[model samples]
Target: MVSVEVLNNHPTGGALCAKGRAAPEIVASPRRLTVPLKRTRPRGAADPGWVEVSWDEALTEIANRLGAIRAESGAEAVAFGVTTPSGTPMVDSFEWVERFIRGFGSPNLIYSVEICGWHKDFAHALTFGRGIGFPDYDNADAIILWGHNPARTWLAQATRIADARRRGAKVVVIDPKPNGSGQQADLWLRIRPGADGALAMGAIRHLIATGSFDADFVDAWTNGSLLVDRATGRFLRADALWPDGAADVFVRLDASGSPVPCDTRYTQQSGGRLRGVLSVRARDGRMISAATAFELLVERAAPYTPARVAELTWLPIADIEAFNALLATRPRLAYHSWTGVGQHTNATAIERTIASLYALTGACDRPGGNRWPVPPPTRALNDYNILPPEQQAKALGIAELPLGPPAKGWITARDFSRAVLEGEPYRVRALVAFGTNFVVSQGHSERNKAALNALEFQVHIDMFMNPTAESADFVLPASTPWERDALKIGFEITQAAVETVQFRPRMVEPVGEVKADYEIAAALALKLGMHELFFGGDIEAGWNYQLAPLGVGVEDLRGHPEGRRFPQAFRDEKYAVTREDGTAAGFATPTRRVEIYS
Candidate 1:
């Protein structure tokens, strides 16, 4: 069908162009005025009377009202919420948004931690002092992927993973589903979900039962050598002995009485002596002799045999042993896990279990192993990192905003919801959400909506009117990525090839009468007389000032969309040790050699 019409600009500022080939019918204001206005509110016992207004009025009310609430009821009375960065293309902007909310000081900075990457972070941190990010694409010999489906969720990551395989990395995928990435893997170990820990443990047993365990590495570089005191329950040490408590499993206070950082052992790149002692005690709390790394590995892994893992996980004994056999080879391995393992009841413990595999194999902080990603400078503005201290405090407050202490102990996101709904400690009153998609994101949608509806103040920001936006008292239209400006620092992984950095430019106008989140923040600060507290001056001017010191101006970024890259940057090189008297240093553990035993 064809329609032809010459028309003036519409009242909404949209051009009144006639429809061509396949198009929707367009009616003018006359049709709008004749129809009864669609009912603004649904029939409900818990509706926050809806009101229509101009953007100025909306912003003014939100800024003033929220500030007033904080002044009168204390910061605890308000909640600042932002959920997962699930569907948005503005992955980089989230870091900025998090800083903005924390700067606001509501203390309820709820994020997509338990839902997204907590398990991975915790597990990797235990072994490598950081979460496992992928190794460089060309360097991997064998890649074992468990509990991650990057294609559907992280397309960019999937591309890199595929690139690695094309470069000769042997890809082994362990997952229940025939996911897009898994289907392309050379080896697919399809076990039931939630049984990964059992599978990994079974591998450990096989490695131990067979002679393929890396005894030299385990003896020199791990806590595996330390023996466990079953009766008194403390790690056996060469010197002092202490009764075991819940937190006393690993490291303890040194001679200076300061607690020896638990993961320091993983960071040691060479042979060293440990200042703190591992200890075991008798029933009467008397000292017993210390054991070596061999003692710890044997004792801790005793309960997780092939048959026991089969029983716990419902996997066959044979499959478990095969996995165990592969692990026994002591090949350099990189491990990663995500929400699938973290969203359960025993998330933290599960993470610790996975972490042990890395430490056992001496793969932490090595080349061709998983390490944190380091972003190149060409991708970023070399500006002085400056954001107000109050703002910093506000962002961290998000984790603490529920008032008093968290009623229920922390575990997973589901547990957090249970604590809120049950009001074990107190009620969850006011909620100000940014980029939160309660419908699809939450594990339980019906219950999440119920909890959201019960809030006193509900605000949302988005480019479109999604279910979450419809439930809000105020809806602030946020700009898409192309219309905004900011800096993004990705995690550092490995020093692979040339250090490359890139930037994307805003390609179009903001969707509607929306604003960049930072500008929105500035406007609110101006309205609330908090300009000095947040941006120091006008937000744009503040941004200009920040840019000037970095040897570039606003014009440079706006004109050059493609970012600069740094050449010949040192990334993965030998870690250095320094001496007190102008000489290279040695390893700093108790046994000068890689301590096979402490």
Candidate 2:
């Protein structure tokens, strides 16, 4: 392409960061890999005879090698790899890549998610079957940016926060190193690194101590009133109270301080005033001491006072108190976290504590707070269940660390190294990586190098020849996003953002024999005899399928390069709304609530 310019909605459509502004350069770079390369020398050699080959030859070789490995070692021997999409053109084909992996029957996907987007994309689901949500910054009254500096990361969000600040919204930024945005905050908490959990707990303590937590929300939408057996640290089940009661039924205390049998049957408010401690009679005629979920949480958070947190975080007591005071205000409390709070060993626990702390505000699905705005309908892309259970069971780390990344078919670099180097769980002989530069992006560069070299066969698909691709037996060229006509579902920050859809028209042609990620995956799938699964390599057909729910088609999107707005709008405070079935719209959690105690 000769040049590129901002497409509609134009300047206000969405602000651009430096990375976005450099798109033209990224597409027309002098270093663009235009041809397929085949390594004809031994692994770890200084100069692998780089030979250019036809796409047919490259695809045939990759298909044969990957197929043979899968046939011999049950598909678990070949691990597929992907990089984070947020920072690259990989976003356009993220779903298609996963589909290809599943269609190929490999349960392991070597993705750099453990320290990038995992906390915001998966860990939060443990508490409520969902992850971090889009913050309603436009309608927000107060914004608590915990470990998230949108100015440096999210330009559109930064613009919204600036507008909120101009309208006098209270802005409190928590980061070790305050940036320009944090500097502009009404209050910036210079917290010590890795102490976000303590600060979150301190905030929770303050909310509860000042009587600022949403009691009605807590009673109705959380497990705060559920009784927990103090001895076993488990929910006191109904089977403990009666011989015939189901184990899934838990005990709850009613308004009259009476023990009541509870299940996930009803998600509405329970007018219970249970707190502190009490003893309940069991089926075995024993008195078991129990505490309400609320009391247990309160007890857990009791020790993390502002003073205590000041020592743990190195922030002044007054700063913690000031944050407490702001959180106690009547305005909606909107908060967010990023990788900063998710890179450490105790990141999960820290994130969970922050999640629990945020639950106390009752700001979810509300105006001026964090929310999951319902988007215009689209067909779901992920269908990992297509892989048989036996294949799924071969995920590298699932057998040992059941709750880790492997539980969801994701592979950490450490596990990938182990599978390739040590073959602890199973050996990974071949690797097909798309846009993933494990050398620069993942931890332990030396270990990753060894693992990459140890692979019997490796195929890399990327625009530039990075260090990670040095070990590849074949290096296939990939097209830039500018050369791909990809449909963007939504901006996903607010309801308005979700209502708008865009079809980013391809601006340029591939430099040489390069192909888009989807094209490569589709061709590879066909070569592997998975023609039906890949829609016969027809990408637009898949795009049309995804657009069916919105009464739109790929041609319609192609006609509107600026964007097209859907008719339906997002609804707010969803849990408070009674449905036609006479039941409230609850959360996606097992308990159908925010699940504070889960």
Candidate 3:
């Protein structure tokens, strides 16, 4: 039984939010579907004509129909749609589903990247070549909540922020409304929406103009000193000027006005002192004037003055100046934003600007700054090579977006509807969705419904029959957490700040003919002759494989329902050290340095 007393263990200090307290009621609701139902009517029919079916019968019919569709229309006609793990834990099945789809020869995996953290991931990867890590609230002297409202969204993080404020950490909240986080902030800037990029650029200009940035870190650890060609707007490679210089090696003007290799060893030995702008001659005897990437960034940010940003964002210039002043003085500062900033059309630029500002302060991967989480030990689950090269080229959003695809051959949720309805690049005849509420969750519900109506076959696996399920040809019942045995290694919101691993056994027997999502996936894989690839229909085998690197097994977790913690300690400035191979272990990027230009 799930007791209300369990709430005490939560990070919110026994303060259970309405949703947390209502979880038991929602799980035991009468509307829960406990059996598989097959629709016998045609597409767009008024009545679904759902008929109860046995698990074996439902799996067989789905496999046969999908096989027939694939044989007739090719594998590109099929697609898979999934939502975030908070609403549905189908994220855990991502690798298995990808394996199944690739083995079946399809390249379409539609997901909620655009509406979630795709912009943040893509922007940070483009700039720092890694996902933006969570802030270290415990050690922070100051925190900026930009476009994020954690109080109502993530109670655990909000609790930590509240505790940080109690310990005298200055809090600044930048949002359009008086949100829950804003209510408790030391300074709240109610700026206009969609103006985050401008504000960030303005702040960067202020920092650069006032010499508030960490110049030492920028010169030593980033590509800020690498010279950029004025003609092509590309980094000036050393090989272009010196015949024997490496092609990947970049050049920076030394004290003698000559180009030198801009490697980390040279920067460390030179004490991070280099010319910001210089003129040089190429092998072709052409005189080229170049400026360092830092100078170029300053030039780009020059136009966004505080007054201009105030006009654009409808925020006070004084407030913007004050915020920048606070950021400049704080020794341990961190800023975070989420979906609100990621939902814009110019989200990539916005997130990149935010990351650039953060990098200027030298607050990344530090004790009291934004720290990268210690990742759980696990094998690479997504087998990228499973999909053939030809099918990968047909992904829907590649030509349009250019970036933002999670994998080389995946489509975003924004493009799924059009790809299915119009079939512009290719037709998508079938959709197998797990826990996605497309009808109400996606924009333009009518259009999403029409796209669903266009599909030749649709399968929905969920705990309840939602609008999406109502339109699906097959609605398979899914097991709840209460009726299943599961393992969770870390808290998603906290980013493993308090590292833990917990195993939850079945609290009660399953209500009816319901099965776990992985079980259904395994059963379908068996029917498709991929049982061996899926570990002979064994979910435990998959878990064990995932846990192999951690030196733990399912057997080890069987008796410990409360879970255990593995010891770990955070290290500062770890990114600048050398690797086991004796090479520099700088930020992961094309240049092996933080790329403000890219």
Count of clashing residue pairs in every prediction = 36, 0, 0
lDDT string, candidate 1, 1-598, tens digits: 1343322121111122222211222222111111111114552436545555566777777877788777875554556556554435345455445445544554445556656666676434444344555554445566676777666655545666787778776676777776776798877677776777776666655666665765555544555434434445455332333344233234333334333323323434223222223543544667555433454555556788777887877767776666665566665665556666766645655666666665566555466666444444332211112334443343322355322112111122343344356753334456666666765575787776766666566677665556755667677766655556654322233343223233345555544356766566566656766556455535445544544534554455555444433434343411233345533221233422233333
TM-score of 3: 0.94
Clashing residue pairs, backbone N/CA/C < 3 A, model 3: none
- The superposed Cα distance between candidate 1 and the true structure at residue 153, in angstroms, equals 2.7
Model 2 worst lDDT run, 10 consecutive residues: 3-12
* Model 1 regions more than 4 Å off: 1-52, 85-87, 166-168, 226-285, 289-294, 374-424, 491-503, 536-555, 567-598
User: Model 2, range 163-218, lDDT digits (tens) per residue?
Assistant: 99999899999898887668879999998999999998998888888889888888
RMSD of 1: 9.5
From the highest lDDT down, the ranking of the candidates is: 2, 3, 1
TM-scores, all candidates, are 0.73, 0.95, 0.94
Q: lDDT per residue, candidate 3, 341-388, as tens digits?
A: 887888889988888888889888887788877766666445768778
lDDT of each: 0.51, 0.83, 0.78
**Greater-lDDT candidate between 1 and 3:** 3
Local error of candidate 3 at 353, Å? Answer: 0.6
